[model samples]
Target: MIKKYLSATLVGLSLLAASSSSSAKVIDFEDINFSPSGGFSGQDLTQRYGLNFTGGRYGFSTLTATSYSGWGAHSGNNYAWGDGYNMGIEISGNNITLNSFWVRGALMADDVGSITVRAFKGSKAVASKEFSYTETYHLETFNFAGIDRILITSRGSGPVLLDDIDVGFASPVPEPASYAMLLGGLGLLMLAARRRKSS
Candidate 1:
């Protein structure tokens, strides 16, 4: 009996996870503009900044930017940083979430720094993280209420492209034990139906 209940609960959880509020829907890409400055890349930071379909360094919308793969010096920390693109979004609603995702490099660096996703509440830094360095990409999610602005930045050095900047509402669902309790209550319906048939 417990096995059946657990299976049912898992199915319901998966269903909720696949729902609308659970996923970050793409609103727009705006457009990728060139930013030679404000990055850690070399060659006077001369690299295309706008999003391109063929070579996308960052993919949140239709547009994405590719970076210049070079061992560059990062600002302040002087850490080696890769050349990635910067994306800005207008935050609204009661709550907001920033899901950080990275594209793994085919040729991973020995001393790869880290990718940093910065959460900005109207130009104010709230939270940040250093993503791992490898050929496999990873995703990180954060939750906030009444957010106004957001910015994502890279921490490590070299060239890496990021895609799928998911910013949207996070859905709330009933807990598994709650689900079990609800399902247990549903058994009463079967009892009622049998009574009526016997009568």
Candidate 2:
């Protein structure tokens, strides 16, 4: 009986470690960008509120409620002013969790607009948030189970930027009891497998 139990325990530990190892890790990925083709010009004297992504291009671009003067198709199309031109990304993971990430944003007027953010896990809405324009340089954190997608939104006139996005398991991650149970289950399964093999 002791031999069976020991074999079971080891198997469980191995499985627990394997699953734990696969959790999403934090890394620097392309957060947002504002393409230069749209009057960015990359000029020194150009608009200071330029949207530069991690890759320096316009994939997953960002916009704010605050509009810029002499920008976009017309003056009204400026990045701010709640013209509704914004960008976002989709992120999710398996057996993993997500916490708050950082964002860069500011308001030209006191009437900063509203912010809308949505998160998903395999086509399911896992989380969402909307903040008033009063917040600046907001570092929003979120925790989720088996995360799989991320969504960000903004409205009105503000200049918002996002970068250095980090994703990982929750603090005090891999709860002790959860690990214990996982390891125990694996150990029992292994013992059964070995017994079947011997037979």
Candidate 3:
């Protein structure tokens, strides 16, 4: 009975450690407070979302009924908008796998266009893809792994809208001391099992 209990405890510990290490997050841009005019710029979202936005021309805005006639937000009332051709998003602490995101062309008249997404680790570009969109929002999927930064550039006539960025954080590596503790627990379990068998 003691051996069985120890084995279960060890398994539970392993699972707990794993569960704490990795997680998936979706940035919907809804939590940001927009101005009374329904749009705002120069707000720092790093503290709230762990994403540092470079290229000073990016901001958040609402997709109202009157404005952005054909386009809509992927999830909520708000979405990220960039007037500049290029925008950069830097992950705060660790590298992440950028899974997918929702995007659309911003202009009502010139809404048909393409955008290029590039993932980088440090200064090295790892992955890149171009996606085309109409006035309606569409999901763009990617398997950009081990990337610390992502650059988005518009290839069309106008700006772009973005929302629902899905990303997975890399699992935190277990410390050496954690491995030692696990080994010690296994040793204790083996010793207990031997004693029971001999007795």
Candidate 4:
């Protein structure tokens, strides 16, 4: 009976872990602490949500829609304005995929120019694409996989805007240890049931 109980518990735990590991998340730039109508340095945002940033070091500003007519808030009352086109944010873990994000030009009248998004693993470049932005916000999606870093660079000298960055990973495959624990528990449970029946 104790062995059966132990086995059942192991199976439940393994299943719970598997489910939790498969979930993904999005960063709306709304939850974190930011000065109202203020800018954040690149280092300030690094690893805030499992993401690290590099290059184009000036960072972005968090401002209200009233502060800038052209910068529309993506989700909440606030949004981020890219200081320039040269910076990129990298996901901290290995084997992450570039999912999607919302971006637009930061200027009220002039075009903000084009920006390029690139995904890389170590020194190897995996995928890249360029986008042109006007005054309106646009949602961009990517299917690049095995990415460790994502770099966004502007084609022009003007500032860019970004919001709602999403990232995902492949579903977690049960590790060998997890499988072993689960199977061992199940086998013990079955054996216990059979013994109980015989008795």
Worst 10 residues of 2 by lDDT: 43-52
- Worst window of 10 by summed lDDT in candidate 1: 72-81
Error of 4 at 40 (Å): 11
What residue pairs clash in candidate 4, if any at all? 85-154
| TM-score between candidate 1 and the true structure | 0.37
CA lDDT scores, all candidates in order = 0.42, 0.47, 0.68, 0.65
Cα lDDT tens digits for candidate 1, 1-199 = 5465567656765665565354455322223344434442222122222111221233322222234344221211122123443322222333466554334432345435455555556667777655655544444555544354444444444445344445556555556776576556555645565678789
lDDT of 3 by residue, 1-199 (tens): 6767677777857875775575789988776655534432334444456656654244432223223445457787666666534443444346788999988776576667777788888889989998787777889999898888887766665656778889888776777787778778777877887899999
Model 3: residues with Cα > 4 Å off, grouped in runs: 1-13, 38-47, 56-71, 84-93, 185-199
Candidate RMSDs in order: 12.1, 10.8, 4.4, 4.8
Point out the higher-scoring one by lDDT: 1 or 4. Answer: 4
Candidate number with greatest lDDT:
3
lDDT of 4: 0.65
